[model samples]
Target: MENDAETEKEKKNKNNKVIVGSIICTLLVIYLGMATYFRTHFYFGTEINCVNVSAKTIKEAAKQMTSQMESYKLSLKEKSGKTEQITSTEINLKLSSNDEFKRLKDKQGSFNWIFGALDSKNSKLKANIIYSNKLLQEKINNLSCLDSKNIIEPKNPSFKYSSTGYVVLNEVNGNKIDKDVLYKNIVNALSTGTTTLNLDSTNCYLKPKYTVKSKKTSEIKNILNKYVSSKIIYTFGDKKEVIDGSKINKWLNVDDNYEVVFDNSILTKYMRKLFSNYETIGKTRNFVTTSGNTISIGGGDYGWDINSSEDIQKLIDDIKNGRTVTREPIYLQTAASHSSDDIGNTYVEIDMVNQHLWFYKKGSLVTQGDVVTGNMSLNTSTPAGVYRLKYKERNATLKGEGYASPVNFWMPFNGGIGIHDASWRSSFGGNIYLTSGSHGCVNAPYYLAQTLYNNIDAGTPVVCYY
Candidate 1:
């Protein structure tokens, strides 16, 4: 009974060994069959040139790749959100078949086909793409973005004057194409057999040199605001001339490079306007003489004269520093008062019509005398205008074209004309000036000339009018 049981066990063990051997043989045959298949056909999950070629033979894969290349169209997504296309037919694109597929298959051996099937295998085979360069360039040039009429040019960020102050202008996102970059990306897409190309993603659009987010934009904005924020109050006696942002804004500008610039010519023009308005010298003045007659006297060099160039430089500095202050402009010359009448109370008034003179000190007549002005017959009549006293001298010899005379006191007001005590004149005043008068000199009595020379100060206005 033991021998029979042992024999049954041996037979059962042999049957089990045969069953295991048959299963091994079936798996080995299947593995060998798949390896053989992969020698000609691509493994599963294989891709070439971004095109799926899994389970396809080389001929089939090449045909499929050629068909895809024939049907290939690159879609360009523009910055303007517009979609455009460049087809293989337009560019005459073709896939020049090479040994790249065979080489790739050899590199990815059939023995490793199991691993390749298990994992994804993305193989890049340089398909040796060929196309007419001229045709491709023509297609690129014909794109909508490349059209001059359809393209909107990009604008750099700038500054604009608003109701309150300067504000930053936003940059313009234009549809202008960077042709070189676009062409390169297109060639790359064609070489890789890519279907869609985002022009925006490739930065193919021409960008503004300075955008609103650029640091230079913010710097220029701050600089312009600082320039316009200045407040300058010019005090002209009781009158106040204010220079604030409204006026300064006109002088400020942003240059092409996003830099702040001041228009110096405009500032100079503004200073010239101020000179025209405030300058008193040679301006027409309405004056009331001792005779109570309001007369218009226009010629004189005795009032305000502004130094415009110096003041313009100072104003530029002030605006740059953003300074706010009250001050007067630089003056080449100034008057006694900024009132309607620049000549104050103390002055020398000569009445040429009456041939008389009156020296007033603080609105009071310090001295009065009859005077011989000029020889009207000789056309040397004393000029009629307001002037300033040049100087006072004593024991001066007055020389002229025809005569030389000695004087006790000399007070010259106008050029070569003066108030002097002339002993040559026995009498004074009246139409003696019409015929035989002192040559353009106020021939005063010795007492009157001495009093004026002693009491009057230099630069005092000498009012001589007919």
Candidate 2:
């Protein structure tokens, strides 16, 4: 009875041990089921593409990311310190259901739940992406900054002149959108999953074609600036014109080889205008004689005539050399000082109708005489108008194209005409010249000729009028 009792006790103890072992095994199986829940989901520390995907299933992770992407907005900076944005809607940004996602999901080691749970490794994951490049380009093109109407063209450097003289003006680069560069950067950003695009930092904006430092622009600016520094002021008797470097620069031209060329026509025109106003001679004039006689004179070669062509050439050279000067214009003829008619008071006056002669020295009557002029019946009348005294001699024989005559004193004023001693005739003045008059010569009395010859000199003005 004792042995049977002990055996019974041992069998019951064995049954208890077996039941406890089975219960422990069942608990272990349940624990494994809970822990391995991660087998189909991401690891506790898993990250994909820098996004936390830990404790998320494959579809859950994809949906979460896709939803987040729909609200994505790319911040863009523009040229003029302005900010812009590119929305997902504009580019048709969306997730693509492709094998890439599955492959990434497989790389998570989700089947080895225990190992995945213990792993703390970081991973960069690329999800399958789908976006419309054409839509993105179109959206960028439609931006207000990219609009042609809103685009600002760059200005080239300039050389300007003012009261301050030559000035080098800087260029304005302005605002310009570069389609190719911007498109490239945007495409690169999108492909690489970039969130921000800086137009200024990336050099995506179009640059100016001519900058202040550009070689060609700088060269032109320098040339023009140097050209404008020369100040040329032209002056006539009372007229003046100031030609600064600025005006000369306008008349300058540069070839591709950078050779400077000045406009000769402009200079010619300027000289022509100057001559039109300042030139004298060939115009009506009023004169006052030494004897207090006011005469309206219209014929003479005794007035100012500017040398336009030569002076203009000289002006061009002065401008090219960048000279600053104040000067008078070149002239061809000169008139009397402070005299309007170009004829001063000291001159000889003769009246053919009255056959009279008068001489004045320094505006005072010095001598007077009566004279017989050329024969009127033969149309050899003494020529009338203004002439200068040619010469004087004590005793001379005068030869003409038609006749020769002898005289004691000769004061020839007009061509082949003179004041001479006609001792051969006893009378002077009046109509003896009608039938027996000297050919185009002034026949005077002997004593009168000596007096006139003693007073007159060469180059003395002789006036003869009817």
TM-score of each: 0.73, 0.46
> Where does model 2 exceed 4 Å of error?
1-258, 289-293, 324-328, 382-384, 388-398, 406-426, 431-459
- For candidate 1, give the lDDT of residue 419: 91
RMSD of each: 5.1, 12.5
Off by over 4 Å in 1: 1-20, 57-59, 95-97, 117-122, 126-142, 146-184, 205-230, 245-275, 312-324, 348-359, 366-458, 464-466
- Give the 10-residue window scoring lowest on summed lDDT in candidate 1: 117-126
Clashing pairs in 1: none
Q: Which candidate number maximizes lDDT?
A: 1
lDDT of 1 by residue, 82-166 (tens): 8899999998898776477887777777766777756544344556888999999888878877889998988898678876777
Clash count for each candidate, listed in order shown: 0, 2
**How high is the CA lDDT of each candidate model?**
0.85, 0.72
The per-residue C-alpha lDDT of model 1 at residue 457 equals: 86
